[model samples]
Target chain A: MEKTINLTLKVWRQANATAKGAFESYEVKNISTDSSFLEMLDILNEQLINENKEPVAFDHDCREGICGMCSLYVNGRPHGPDDEVTTCQLHMRKFKDGETITIEPWRSAGFPVIKDLIVNRNAFDSIIAAGGYVSVGTGGVPDGNAMPIPKVDADEAMDAASCIGCGACVAACKNGSAMLFVSAKVSQLALLPQGKVEAARRAKNMVAKMDELGFGNCTNTGACEVECPKGVSIANIARLNREYLKAKCLD
Target chain B: MGTFFSSSIGKKFVMSLSGLFLVIFLLVHLSINALLLVPDGGEMFNNAAHFMALPLIKYGLQPVLFVGFIVHIFYATMLTSINNKARGSVKYAGGNNTKDVMWASKNMYVLGITVAAFMAVHLCDYWVPLQITGNVESTTLHGTEMHDTYALVNAAFSQCWRVALYVVGALGLSLHLTHGFWSAFQTLGASNSLWRKRWTVIGTIFAWVVGVSFSLIAILQHFFYQA
Candidate 1:
């Protein structure tokens, strides 16, 4: 059965990056339960447009949970309350009728608020730019099955590769640590043959950049894994520790 | 290597290694403490104390133990400060509100401070008198002239407030260890998905035993000791 509900939306508003932001309450009514959270926001924006008020601006692209763009700290959780899904994937049914949903941007020093419900996640790009890619020779096509990559390594690499760099791990982390994101990036590449040659250098450089960028250290609280939309594991963090230590110490 | 220790993972490695070392010392200390319950009139305990008082352990390893403890606390404070900075000055009106993180894992530094506070009391009641001040009365147990370390412990536990202090301290240490044990393994990269679960279960059991047993023995001595 289809359902529609009324909600009190507490949306954040800021004119620019330096402008102070605050939650401005507005009533969004008759929202379809099946509509995505973003669509519900679109309805609210239309209402705001009819009122001749500035619409709440939030980052969103490829609203199917892949673009890693839509981020909202809704009611104290990053990407809203729906489990293992982005804010765009969150359906209105997950919320109660007449519930006042508080939506804010990702709060972290590494991710500063740009506007209402939008923060700069370019720090992640900086860490990736440091050493997140595998160097390729780029010549003739290599034969498949020649290197004989282990199945476990390939699978684990793929799992780590699922990270979308959305900064949810950072948003959800108590310390604002980027360990999960960096570890996922590091683990995905380090597990594969193409990335192994530069693994040591990658670990050292990436970690250096992460710390340099003012991210906190991991204390293994496991909060990052819990709130991650990608379901990325903290085991990659342990792997990163192993990689970094091997590069810095015994290697 | 000079500058590598300043990295985030490097700091964690230091914290875990220092913590694991203290974990070893806990076992040794607990084993000796168990001797307090032997009921042989402190003979075996005094002998063990005398052996522990031997120059090598008393002088050599004692300093190392202190260093390990200091390193753990120092780096923890430094890291927490850095983490606070990383968290920024912005207070999220909506809190993290996460229930998945273990209580001990989140409150490790606070628990560590509690344990350290207890250690100050502990050193005053036992270590200071026995090891440094030489104020504990001497006794010849089974023809062995020793520092009457058993008497120092027994007399202390005999007091109601003293036993209560120990109970609090032991429980604090226990909470600290529950997270520290498995977390140290994770930091050292010795744990995975399967092993992490195994380590967490093992660590919880180990924490309860080590913590509550101290309370048990303290209660026992406070109520049951004679002479």
Candidate 2:
């Protein structure tokens, strides 16, 4: 049986990073329960366009939940009320009829809002650029199974690699700490044999960049793990700390 | 190294290391204090206290301990302020879900401040008089003349208000340690899943041990051994 919901959205509206932002309420009627949250916003945007009013702006790409572009704090949770899923994957079925949902962009000093529901996430890019890649010589691809990687190490590496960098962890954190995201990048490389060569340097540089970028320190609150779309473990944060401490010790 | 120490994680690492050092000191302090429970009329405690007050520990290790406290408190305040600013000016319309985070973990600064405040009172009551003023009465025990530190401790704990303060302080320290013990390990990179789980359990047990033991002495002194 097909169902529909009528929702009242209190979406944050801001002209730019410097402008004052506020929540503007709008009624979205008869939205199909099967439509994703982003789709429902699309309907509202279309209505605003027809009325000749400025439409709401939100960032989204690869709606399949992989691009890590959709960032929304729906009802106090990153990516709506859903666990381990992005905003685009949130469906109307989870909402109640006439329920008022509040939406806002990622709130952090590191992520300044560009407009409504869109914030600058280039801080992450900068941190990654600092030391997220492995250095290797230009040559033909290494033969498969050339490196006998333990299955456990490979699995853990893959798990850490699952992070799409959606910035949900920062939105959900009370301190706005990006430890989970930074740790994912650090751990993904640290767990692999190829990334072990510069693990210490990578850890120090990435963490230094994260702090320089104005991200909060991780207090082991576990909020980031709960709200992370990719289920990035806080253990990765522990590894980053270890790698960092080891590097400092050697220095 | 100075730059690393100035970094956020470096500050956290320093905090955790200092915290763990304090935790170990507490265990040693508690064991020596436990001698009061013996019916030996403060002989064992006085001897132990005399040894701890020796020039080696008093002048050398005591300064290191003081530095540890200073560093811990300094970074704690610094990190708290920076974290508040990092959260940005806009408050979330809906508050965070409490299920995802430990109450102790979220309010660590408050608990730390509570413990720090109590530490002031504690030093005023004990350390100041014994170390600086040398006003603590002396007793000859085991053929050695030493400050009757056990007498001072007993007199303080015998009072109901003093016992109450100590109990409250212990509770604050317990909450601080509950989050801090494992968190320090995590901050230092004990993030493996199995070890993290074990650390949590061990941390909880350690917190209780320190809290209950400290409070027990105060309550016992108040009720059982009235000065």
For residues B111-140, what per-residue lDDT tens digits would candidate 1 score against the true structure? 999999999999887888898889878999
**Lowest lDDT block of 10, candidate 1 chain B:** B91-100
TM-score of chain B of each: 0.97, 0.96
Off by over 4 Å in 2: none
DockQ of 2: 0.67
The per-residue C-alpha lDDT of model 1 at residue B5 equals 88
Q: Rate the local accuracy (lDDT) of all candidates.
A: 0.90, 0.90
Label model 1 with its docking quality class: medium
Q: Among these predicted structures, which one has the highest DockQ? A: 1
Please provide TM-scores computed only on chain A for all of the candidate models, following their numbering. 0.97, 0.98
For each candidate, give its TM-score against the true structure.
0.97, 0.95
Candidate 1's error at A157, in angstroms? 0.7
User: A1-251, model 2: which lDDT tens digit per residue?
Assistant: 88998999999999987899999999999999999999999999999999998999999999999999999999878998888899999999889998999998999999999999899999999999999999954357788777788898889889999999999888888788999999999989988877988888898899889998999988998899888888888988888888888888888
iRMSD (Å) of candidate 2? 1.3
